[model samples]
Target: MRKGKLYLIPTVIAEETQAVVIPPHILQALPGIQYFLAEDIRTARRYLSSLKVYESIEPLIFEVLNKNTKADQLKKFFEPVFQGNDLGILSESGCPGVADPGSLAVKFAHEHDIQVVPLVGPSSILLALMASGMNGQRFAFHGYLPIDGKDASAIVKTLEKESRSKNQTQIFIETPYRNNTLMAVLMKSLADDTQLCIAVDVTGKDESIRSYSVKKWKSIPVTFPKSPAIFLFLSH
Candidate 1:
C-alpha cells in the first residue's frame, strides 16, 4: 500500500479574517483531509466549518498536538498516515511548524518517509517582518523570551547587542496577556536609537504595525493590547 502525505496547514491569525488570509487552494485541499492534528480540536473544527467546505465535519478525526503533547505519543498520532490516510497538522494560529507545536510532527514525518506539504497562508512572524521595515535579509526569530522580568530583560539586551554587531533583525513573541509586561521590558532594555517594531493583530481589521526608536516608544505612553503580537528590533 502507498504511504500517506503530511500536510502542514496554515490557519488564520485573527478571527473572521479567513476569506482575507486563507487562499482558494487551501479550501480545495480540505475535502481530501479527514485526519487532523490540531492544538485545539474545538477551534480546528470551528475553523474548518467556517470555510464551508464540508457538509458535515462529524466524520473527521482530530487528535491533539500542542505544547503538552509528548514525543513518545507521536507514533500513535501518525498511525493514520501510516495506514495511507493523508494527515493534516493545524496550528492554533498561522502556519503549522513555523512557531507552532506542529514542528514535532513534521520532524517525525521527515524521519519516516512521508511527503510533507505546506499550504501557503498568513504567518504572523513573516507578516510582521514584512511590514516592520526592518532588516529582512538578516533576521532571526527567537520564539518567546524568558517569562521572568529580569531574565527577559537580560535576554533582550543580549539580543540587542548581537543585533548591533550583526545588523540582524531580532524577532520574538509574547503570550497575549503578558503583552504589556514584555513591552515595558523592551522599552527599558533597548537603547535609544534601537528601532522597535510592534506588529499587533497581523492581517486583521484592527491590524497595526508600527516601528519607532526606543526613545520615541518611551514618549508614546502606550499600553499593549491583549492580542497576538510580534516584536522586532534592529540596532546598528
Candidate 2:
C-alpha cells in the first residue's frame, strides 16, 4: 500500500481575520483533509468549521499534539498515515512545525518515508520581519527569551552584540502577559542606537508595527498589551 502524505497546514494567527489572512487555495484544500493533529482539538475544530469546507466536522479525526507530547506517542499519532490515510498538523496559531510543537510530527513523518507538504499561510514571525525594515537577508529567530530579569537583560545585550557583529536581524517573542516585562528589559538593556521593531497583532484589525531606535523607544511612554506580538532588533 502506498503511504499517505503528511500535510503541514497553517492556521490563522489571530481570530476573526481568517478570511483576510488565510488564502483561498488553503481553504479549498481543507475539505480533503480528514485526519489532523492539533495543539488544541476544540480550537482546531472551531477553526476548520469556520472555513465551512466540510459538511460535518464530526467525521474529522483530531488528536492532541502539544509541548507535552512525548516521542513514544509518535506511532499513535501517525498511525493513519501508515494505513494509507493522509494526516494534517495544525498549530494553535500561525504555521505548523515552526515554533510550534508540530515539528515533532513532521520529523516522525520523514523518518517513516511519508511525504511532507507545507501549505502557505500567515506566520507572525515572517510578517513582522517583512514589515520591520531591518536586515532580512540574514536573520535568526529565538523563539522566546529568558524571563528572569537578569537573564533576559543578558540575552538581549548578547543578541544585540551578535547582530552588530554579523549585521543580522535578531527576532524573538514573549508570552503575551509578560509583554510589558520583556519590553521593559529590552528598553533598559539595548544600546540607544540599536533599531527595534515591535509588531503587535500582525494581520489583525488593531495591527501595529513600529520601528524606532532604542533612544526613541525610551522617550516614548508605552505599555505593551496582552496581545500576540513579535520583537526584532538590529544593531549598528
Candidate 3:
C-alpha cells in the first residue's frame, strides 16, 4: 500500500521573502521531501537556498497550457505528489494558479483524490485590488492583455467602458519588460479621468504603489516600473 504524502505548498508572495510565517511552513517541509514540483526549477532552488535549506530537492516541471504535452508534463512532474511522497508545488512568484503555474497539478491531484493544501501569504493580485479603492465586491482578473500586438486601444476602451457600466474594477497585468507599453495604451485609450492603480514590487525593498487619474499620469510621462507589478483600472 502506498502511503499518501501531504504536500507543503509555498506561496511566492512578497511576504514570503523573509524566513517567517507561511514560507517557513513550506521551507520546513522541504528537507527529506520525496520530490519538488515547481513551475520553474531554478526559482524553486533559489527559494530553498534563500531559507538556508540544503536538501536535495528534485525538480518536476508543471505547465499551464492545455496541450497533450501539458498532460505529459503533469504526469512527469506531479506523479510523486499523489503516491505518498510529499511534493511541494511552488510558483515562481505569488500563489500558484493565480496567474501563475500549478493549477493543472492541483486539478490532477483533485481528480486523483489527492489532498491539496495551499499556504496563504502575500498575494499581489489581492493586494492590488485592496489598494485600488475600487468596488471590492465586484472584480475580475482578466489576466494579461494581448501580447501579439493586438489592438490595445480597443481592448482598453472595452475594459474601461465595461467597468464604468458594471461598476466593477477591471484588473489586468503585463510582463515586467512591457510595463511602460501597457501604461501608454491605458492612458491613450481610456478616459482622461479614469482612475488607474499601479502596484509595483508589492513586498520588495523597492515596492511602490500609486493610484491616480489617467490625466495625472499624462504630464508625468508614466514610464511603468521595470520590476514585477500589478495594474488595475477602476470606474466607481
Candidate 4:
C-alpha cells in the first residue's frame, strides 16, 4: 500500500499575518506527514514557528521552494515521496495551485500515478467569486499578470474580452506594491460600465470585497496599503 497521500494544503490565510492563524493542532498533525513542499523557506519557517511545532517536529521533513521552481527542483522534491512518502504542498498565502506552487507536483503525480488528495481550507479566488455577484457558473482564474507593464495590459485586455463574451469572471492577482498601478491600468483599459470586484486581504482582519462599475470605482480611493489582493472583472 502507498505510505502516504498528497495533500494540497491551503495556506489560505497563512500568508496574511492579519488573517486566520494556522492552528498548532494542524501543524502538529502535519509532523506525521511524509514531507512538506512550501512556496518559500522563510515563510514556511515562519508558519512552523508560529505554530510552535518547529522544534518538536521529527517525522515531518519539508522542502521549500516557490512557484517559479523548475522541473529539476520538482523531480528532487518528490523523490522521497515517490519512494513511499506522503507529501504536503503549502502556499505562502491562500491555497496551493489556487495561486501557489503545487500544480507541477500535481501534474507530476498524475503522470507518475501518485494518489492526490486535497485538504480543505481558504481559497481567495473562490471567496472573491462567490462574493462578486457575477456569473459564477463559468468563471476563470487568470492567476497573476506579468510584471512587464505591456504584457500585463495585454493579458488584462484579453481577459476582459473573454469575460464580456462568455459572461465569465476574469480573476487576476497582482503584487501588493504595484496593485494601485495595475488597478489604474485596468480601469483605463476596461469600459466605463465594466463591473469590477476588489477582494483584498481576504480571510484577514482587513478583508474587503466591493464591486462597482469601472467609472464609479475609479472615483473612490482604492488604497488598501500593501496587502494581499485578488482583482476580478465580470462582463455584462
Candidate 5:
C-alpha cells in the first residue's frame, strides 16, 4: 500500500493577520488535507477560517498533539496517513517541530519512512534574528529559560558568557504572562555592555523589535503586557 505524506503546515503566530502572514499557496493546500494533528484545535480552526480555506471545518479530523500528548498515543495520529490519506501537522503558532510538540509526530513519520513536507511561514525566532542586527550565521535558539528566578538568572549569565566567547547570538522566549518578569531578570543579570534584542508581537500590529545594551535598557522603562516575544543576546 502506498503510504500518505505528512505536510508540516505553518500557522500564523498572531490572530487576524492570516492574509498578511500566511502565503496563499499554503491556504490553497488546506482543502486537500482531510486530517490534521494540531496543538490547539480551536486555534487551528480559527486560522483556517481566517484564510477562508475551507467552506466548512466540521468535516476535518483534528487530533490533539500538544505537550500533554504522550509518545504512545502518537501512533493513532498516523493511522489516517498509514491508510494512504495525507495529513497535516499544525502548531498553535509558527512552523511545527520547532519549540512545539508537533515534532514528535514528525519524528514518527521519519521513523516509518513517511514523506514530510514543510511549508513556508513566519517564525518569530527567525524574524527576530533578522531584525536584531545580530550574528545570524551563528545563533542558538534555547526555547524557554527556567521559570525559577535563581536558575533562570544563572542560565542567562551562562548564555551571555557563551555569546561573548563564541560570538553566537543566543535566542530564547518566555511565556506571555511572564514576559515582564523575564525582561526584568535579564536586565538585572546581564552585563551592562551586553546587547539585548527584544522582539515583541512579531507579525502583529503592535510589533516592536529593539536591540539595546543592558545599560540602555535599564535607563528606559518598558513593559511587556502578556504578549508573545523573543529575546536575543549578543555580547561584545
Candidate 6:
C-alpha cells in the first residue's frame, strides 16, 4: 500500500487575517484533510472555521502536539497517515517546524520515509526580516533569548559583537508581556551606532516595522504594546 503524505500547513500569524495572509491553495487543500496534528486544537479548529473549506468541522480529527508533547507519543500521530490518510501538521502560529514543536512530527515522517509537503503562509520572522532593512543574505534567528536579566544582557552584547564583526543580522523574539523589558535591555546593551529593528504586530492592521540606532532609540520614549514582535539588529 502507498503511504500518505504529511502536509506541513502554514497558518496566519495574527488572528482575523486569514484572507490576507493564507494562500488560496492552502485553503483549497483543507477540505480533503481529515486528520491533523496541531499545537492547539481549539486554535486549529478556529482557523479551519475561518477557511470555511468544509460545511462542518465535526468530521475533522485533531491531536495535540505542543511543547508538552513527548517523543513516545509522536509516532502515534502518524498512524493515520501510514494507513493511507494524509495528515496535516498545524502550528499555533505561522509555518510548522519553524521555531514550532511541529518539527518533531516532520522529523519523524522523514525517518520513516513519509512524503512531506509544505504550504506557504505568513511567517513573522521572515516578514520582519524582509522589512528590517538589515542583512537578509546572512541572518540568524535565535528563537527566544534568555529571560534572566544578566544572561539576556550578556547574550545581547555577544550577538551585537558577532553582528559587527560578521556583518550579520541577529533576530530574536520575547514573550509579549516581557517585550518592553527586552527592548529596554537591548537599547542599553547595544552600542549607540548599532542598528535595531523592531517589527511589531506583523501582518495585522496595527503592524509597525522600524529600524533605528540604539542611541536614537534611547532618545525616543517608545513602548512596545503587549503583542507579538520580532527584533533584529546589525552592529555594522
The lDDT for every candidate, in the order shown, is 0.94, 0.93, 0.70, 0.76, 0.91, 0.92
- Residue 27 miss distance in model 1 (angstroms): 0.5
The residue-by-residue lDDT of candidate 3 on 138-227, one tens digit each, is 888988888644577788788888899998898888889999888877877878788989999887767788889888878785565678
Runs in model 1 lying further than 4 Å from the true structure: none
Of candidate 3, the 10-residue stretch with the lowest lDDT total is 60-69
Tell me the tens digit of each residue's lDDT in model 5 across 57-120: 8898999999999889978889998899999999889999988888899899999999999999
Off by over 4 Å in 4: 14-29, 52-55, 73-75, 148-151
Tell me the lDDT of candidate 4.
0.76
Q: Top model by lDDT, which number?
A: 1
The C-alpha local distance difference test score for the whole of candidate 1 amounts to 0.94
TM-score of every candidate: 0.97, 0.98, 0.84, 0.84, 0.97, 0.98
lDDT of 1 by residue, 1-236 (tens): 78899998899999999988999999999899999999999999999999999999999999999999999999999999999999999999999999889999999999998999999999999999999999999999999999999999999999999999999999999898999999989888999999999999898888889999999999998887798999999999
The alpha-carbon deviation from the true structure for residue 133 of candidate 5, after best TM-score superposition, in angstroms, is 0.5
**Backbone clashes under 3 angstroms, per model:** 0, 0, 3, 1, 0, 0
Model 4, span 65-158: residue lDDT tens: 6756787777788877767878888777767776666788888888778888776667878888889888889988876788887888788788
Model 2, TM vs. native = 0.98
Model 6: how far residue 200 lies from native, Å: 0.4
- lDDT sort, best first: 1, 2, 6, 5, 4, 3
Q: Where does candidate 2 clash, by residue pair? A: none
Q: Give me the displacement of residue 52 in model 2, in angstroms.
A: 0.4
Kindly report which residue stretches of model 5 are placed more than 4 angstroms away from their true locations once superposed: none
Given candidate 1, what's the lDDT at residue 202? 90
Q: State how far residue 24 of model 1 sits from its true place (Å).
A: 0.6
